[model samples]
Target chain A: MHEATLAANVLKIVSRAAAGKENRVARITVSVGELAGVMPAALIFAFNALKKETPLDRADLILIKEPVTACCDDCGTDYQPGPFPYHCPACGSRSFRITGGEEVRVKSMELKKEI
Target chain B: MCKTDHNHLEDIDLDCLVQEEDLRHSDRLKAAFRAAGVRGIGLLGSPGSGKTTLLEHLVPELMKKRRVAVIEGDLATDNDARRIQAAGAPAVELNTDGACHLDASMVETAFAELPEPKPELLLIENVGNLVCPVDFPVGEEIRLAVISAAEGEDKPLKYPAAVLRTEGVIITKTDLAPYVRVNPDKMVAYVRDMNPHSRVFLAHMDAAGKLVTEAADGGCSLEDWLLG
Candidate 1:
């Protein structure tokens, strides 16, 4: 649902990165965390719909999925949490803070060159 | 290698957060609220989560000492706005129409439509989908994730982003917990499992669907959490 916003922002970043350089984009790679609240299919749909005839048209989107990772403050161990009633597997500490799995970022963009 | 094999054009290293501009706009709004001595609180949850009911009780209580305003976000109809207005506060209805969530710019526009003198506390009751709303800040300095006890204990697990993004969690309809076979404490625990920094609040509703104002939880009550 929010992928359209994300897709628009991807175009913004792409526009900034490609200015005075290339217009045709070949691919855009984005990293999405499992807990980032982004649905991949929906994002692809939004991107495709927004990228028509623009620099991003025909540009492939590559998503790197990052799973939710939590770090135990007690033992300082990082572990992927299971569904519900989550706790640190190592120390069984519920005081652990989430260390990852909320990223929605553009890592790189490939632009097509005439030559 | 074939001449056309070099399909690579130019690789630009972005390594940037998506929607930085949008998030920055929200930050600016947050700063403006703080500077204006206004507190922007966003309430997000599922449909039928008692968000409007909480506001019906909360607005009057808040109006007793503070200037209160509300922006009701819904896909259609201004029913929530009407309810808030009846609760003794000025409210603006924001119909997203088809959008799943409200954003910073939308809040800014709606905030302007509110009747002045500007509110000391602004309650933005966001559209009722947990997944879409979690990603939009909407200029709220304090975001409370509202969950109905009848929705069961697995909601936090199912929507961890809502738990993680929100500053607090308000478990509403606690009086129905017994019938729903849902443990409110377990729901609170699940929130803690996802976010150690989130403040937790419990709210009980009376038989008439009104907030049980006197019922309080440990360390924090709904009033103290929202007011202060």
Candidate 2:
């Protein structure tokens, strides 16, 4: 769905990073948060579908799925809640805020250097 | 070539390089609108969730106080935009073609086409899809997720991302609750439970065909919430 747009963005960045370089991109690692509303499989499918004949054609998209982490404001305890009924496990407080699992970003790229 | 040079590999630390550019388009649009003192809201919901109907009622009421404009996002046709225009607001239609959601770039292009002296408030009616739109931020001050009563009560729990990400939730089609066997109260309760920070409202049509929305208990009115 929206993964196509995300893939396009990734390619744009990879192209810019590879600008003026003779290396071929081998792999691209991206971190997708569980709460980021992006499906990893769809993103990879989009990357494969749209990267043809481009610098990213040979690049393998590596997705790192990050779990949701909630931090309790009162007790300063960080914990990962289950898929449902989010609450601080230690303090039984719902005042905790999600500290992680809300970002989708390219972390790094592996390139094959030319001799 | 030397054996060592043939197998050489380099790892570049991009580390959020794409995200740096991701904020460029939306951030620029937000700054430009903010400088002009124009506030914006991204309205999202499932297809046939009464979004356009709600807008048909809200735009005129809102116009009584502040100038309003709408940016309608759809897969094809300018029907929603035309409807909003008929409702008496300056409207722009962005046909995403095949995209599931409207991105910041589309919003930038549509905003540029809007006439000078932008309206005080802009409501971007995002393409009718809950999942994809939740991930894309279109430089709006507030995000409103609409779920109709007919869509079932467990939608908020099922689509947690949409509920959690929105600043407000509009539960529309309350009049159809009985026919659809949905308890509007329970739906509102579920939405509140999922996201305690979001303001939830129940919208229904009155006898005279006016859209009336009442904020759930402990929630503020849409006008007050949006204006503030």
Candidate 3:
């Protein structure tokens, strides 16, 4: 459901950026967070459908998945549970500061132009 | 003595990619909303759950204190916009066409028609469906989900995504309390059990034209998060 929304956002940025350039897009790098609640497969599918007939029609979307991390304010501990949920390892408190995993950004774009 | 080609690689640095990876989406979204100077409040609920009606009643009171801009979303028609205009707030309609939800791009487009944010509150009337709107972020500071007594209390459990995402729940149509068998207390408890941190409010229009709180209503637990 949100995949379409994500695609629309990507398309908007890519289209605007491409408008300033004469050539087509080469690659678009996007950052996807683990807790962003977006499914990468669905986003890719939606992107493929929407990218056609637009400035980003031939652009390749490169998604980099970011890790989720949380910090405990009380105990001053940071936990990186790569394969598990986001609970604090030392205090076991579900209540902690979310330091990462909520980001969705396009880090950079590559363009092909006439030399 | 073997320093290797690390220095040579560093000198060339061809592997380093110099690209225009834009943080501009976040910047654009933030700038567009900042220019609108208006913070968004989302009214969410299922179709025919009296979300629009509740907005129609509540908006005049809110607008009396501050100028309000409304971004009304529907599958089609400018009906909600007309109604909100009638209610005295300048309203713009976003026709999602066949889409089920409103995304950030659509909202950004609406900003072009509205005035710069005048430190006023903007109300976004989401599409009359609960399932899709919850997944999309329209840059709202407060999201309020409406669940009418007529719609059954199990809705919170049934549609936990919307319920869990909101800062508050406004149970509409308290005037129909007598005809309906809804126990407000139980509904509040159920919502709290499901969301654990959402504020619940029972709304009814009073003679003074205010959405009066009734039945087991209190402050939201999520206020801490919202303020943070």
Task: Pull out the clashing pairs in model 1.
Answer: none
Off by over 4 Å in 1: A75-92, B1-8, B213-217
Q: Identify the superior model by DockQ, candidate 1 or candidate 3.
A: 1
Alpha-carbon deviation at A41 in model 3, angstroms? 11
Clashes of 2: 0
DockQ of 2: 0.66
Number of the top DockQ candidate: 1
Q: What's the lDDT for residue B196 in model 1?
A: 79
Q: List the DockQ of the predictions in order.
A: 0.71, 0.66, 0.15
Give the count of colliding residue pairs in each prediction: 0, 0, 4
Error in Å for residue B34 of model 2: 0.9
Superposed by TM-score, candidate 3 places the C-alpha of residue B49 at a distance from the truth, in angstroms, of: 2.2
Better of 1 and 2 by DockQ: 1
TM-score comparison, 2 vs 3, better candidate:
2
lDDT, candidate 2, B1-228, per-residue tens:
112234687788787734565567678878888998889899999999988998888898888888889999999999999999999999999998888988888898898888877889998999999898987778898999999999998888888889888889999989999998999999887876667678889899999998888998756777767665
TM-score of each: 0.91, 0.92, 0.60
Q: lDDT of each structure?
A: 0.85, 0.85, 0.68
Where model 3 places Cα greater than 4 Å from the true spot, the runs are A1-115, B1-36, B115-119, B177-180, B205-211, B214-216, B220-228
lDDT of 2 at B216: 88
Report the lDDT tens digits of candidate 3 across residue range B96-119: 888877766777778567755543
